[model samples]
Target chain A: MENRTAREYYENYLKTTHRLGRILTASVLILLLAAPYVIGIYLKAMPNIPAVLKAFLGVGIVYLVSGIVEYLIYVPMLGAGGSYLAFITGNLINMKIPCAINARDIVGVKSGTPENEIIATLSIATSSLVTIIVLALGVLLMIPLQPVLQSPALQPAFENVVPALFGAMACKYYRADRKAALIVLTVMTLLFVFVPSLIGSTSMMVIPSGALAIGLSYLSFRKKQKTSEGGNEA
Target chain B: MELLAELNSPVMYLICGGIILFVSVICIVFAVRAYRAGRQLGIDESKMKRVITASTTFAVLPSIGILLGVIALSGSLGTPWPWLRLSVIGALHYETQVAEAASEAAGIGGLSIANMTPEAFATIAFLMSLCIMWGMVLVIFNGEAYSRRLVSPSHPEKGGKKKKSGMSGFGDTAMTAMFIGLVSAYIASYIGTIVSGNGMFSFQGSWLPLAVAVTSAAAMGVFIYIKNRTGADWVDSFSVAGSMLTAMAAAIFFGRLIG
Candidate 1:
């Protein structure tokens, strides 16, 4: 009975979330396109369409693929509502993903559960709101804050945010499964060391490294199952 | 400079600000709905509050990092556009790259505010806005279906019992592995810099990222230890933020020392 209630609640939640998400995201897309259009009309400065397309073709093609890849890779982890919010807000790797992960861990919610989805959505929405506020504040204070924010002394901090963040966040997960973590880390490190040019392709690299880790983990799970079964037989 | 100033005009701010305002409203609605759903799900109000607090805290430094992106791009793209872009559906790196490309294509000679024209500005804005939007578009279409697959049962048998999906069993591990993969790649890239002497920071400053990472990791370890030992709930909320700050401070310290 409790299961039925929970399932019904989740189904309704997804229904509402998807409906809202579609409308909101579609509206956002229209607004985004409208920005350039409105600007072009106001200034009577329409861009050369061919040139824009040509240039976009060069870079947009790459980002288009990356965007699709990121969507597929991230949507599962982010869940339904969180994906809508996070994808729209951007900064997934450096901010929203970590925020959601941390929230889930702190609240002790398992992934793929309705509770986890709610927690992820709440956390991502809060993060997005905070980000918008911060960006607004920074814009308002860009003059006064410029020197400190752009200072060479403080530059390293911003530059290393990825390492700083993932190091700490990854350590928790690494601790959860040390063997898989160590093996994957070693393999990725070697790959990067050998083909340093591949550094720029880290997003794509998530595929191989993830597969390797998952493969190792599955093997471990099977081995553990076998061992337990043997002990049961004994 | 005049063209650049024109690009930063009040109309531009209004357009950008309006979009940002809309996005914020969406965020609020979603957050409220999610919160209510949590209540329906029997989640403790205290826990939901903690999630909000933690997410807000965790967001500060990174959002500031994004602010730095805006500031960097403001010199070229003007304050309003960068502000709007970074505030919604724009990443720091991608915005910079696409804006540069668009600017070059517009004959602005690659992201220079000096020779900017309205046409070039429009081009940059269009390309930057349009290029990275696939994620959102795809999500609009497929997000619900994909999410359902993740949590729903896969196979139904003759007895009317549904078999558990592979995603439910392996989702957590896959997510963890993806994170591990991401971190390893980043850490490895930094390590590569140290070894190859050919990457972004150069050999001299190459050690900085790795050192900062270790410091952050150690700070995280301390936070976890404190949380475990003292049963302090706030420690969990603050661990990532605290560790990031510590690591950033270490970066400055080590940066100066190495120099």
Candidate 2:
């Protein structure tokens, strides 16, 4: 009886959230419609697409596909119009090369509204489109280089780049949230280094590292609270 | 010892040292920038130091492992051993597949893993496995979430609040690192495969490719760290520079070695 009551309550909660989502979706759609026209004249008068247009197109294709996905999933089915606009703009933001200063504007307006929900829903959709487009352009742009992504052996080398980039970012992150950063970084490092040894060659190291980081960070938080309380009493 | 001996080769040392040095210098520069940015942002200094320490460790250790692995493996084998190489590549490919599959299995989160070709499946699996493995290692070592605040020097999140960096953007760095570390490896493999016309471990020229692969892996690690620290602007410049250098180095080194 108690379990049944809980389930019933959950269903009611879900319905309320659903209704809320619909209202938010409508708000975002309204915002999106106004965005382009506001800047459309300037967009029209803009100079020729830079040679970087090719690169933008590469990422843009991916973003476009992602937008299409959003259209199908949210705009059409879920009735999320505002997300459609956010998706379009997000891709545009990503496509800008050398420095697209528009990310702030694109993602910023999302605060404290139904727009945030829609944007969150469309994030992956936008990323997928952008990634695919960028890759296509990358292939064409990098044709002169030849065999960079094509060859089998070299692909592994390419795989490593993402992690290195993350490592660099980790350094910066560490500087900001020292306690949490140290805890997570240390946890991940241990995972990357020791897990392979423990589980043998077949084991995947990164997952454990990421998990460990999150876990340890959580525990450390509790430990910190305990210590701080003890100090207060002393 | 023999592995160390081969690593001592001027060319090999140059490759290893140069790459490591490049990465270290980039990290140091970025760390300083991050420090300044944090200072400007009013992040506590002690907090910044801890983050830096964690980031440095994360960046350096995996990289050293990868670099040393490449140098040692290459030096010892003198030829790319198909089985070992295949397994490593297979692992990466498979991990990626697994991640995709897991996401898809969640329904609406990803494309169906069942639909992927064998190669694609392997790739996803490789990525997923790596993530899992690394995550575990991290937990065992220190047990933290590895979250970091990103204050875009140029683009701040809404209402001037800082945004947190996630692992999603590391994909770009992975691509760059792969090119840098493995172009020669790719060329070698392509030439060997064409010459031999064999399948499943037929590609040759083990050292160059392995080195590239491992270094690229290192780059992925470092890039992740860097992306979290610097602005996208910085990432773009660094990526372009890294890619160009990787291509140039591969061209020069491969030309000399294979010529």
DockQ for every prediction shown: 0.65, 0.04
Give the per-residue lDDT of model 1 (tens digit) for B124-198.
888887898999999998887777766533212211134342233556776777777667767776676676547
- The prediction achieving the highest lDDT against the true structure is 1
* Model 2 lDDT tens row, A3-35: 355335433432443343344333333332332
Off by over 4 Å in 2: A1-123, A137-159, A176-204, A226-234, B1-92, B95-259
lDDT per residue for candidate 1 within A65-137, as digits (tens), equals 8898888888877888999999889988788888998999899887767788899999999999999999999
- Model 1 has a DockQ score of 0.65
Listing candidates in order, what is each one's chain A TM-score?
Answer: 0.91, 0.36
Residue clash pairs of candidate 1: none
- Candidate 1's displacement at residue B222, Å, is 0.7
Quality class of the docking in candidate 1, CAPRI style: medium
When summed lDDT is taken over every stretch of 10 residues in candidate 1 chain A, the lowest stretch is A1-10
RMSD of each: 2.6, 21.2
Which of the numbered candidates is closest to the native, going by highest DockQ? 1
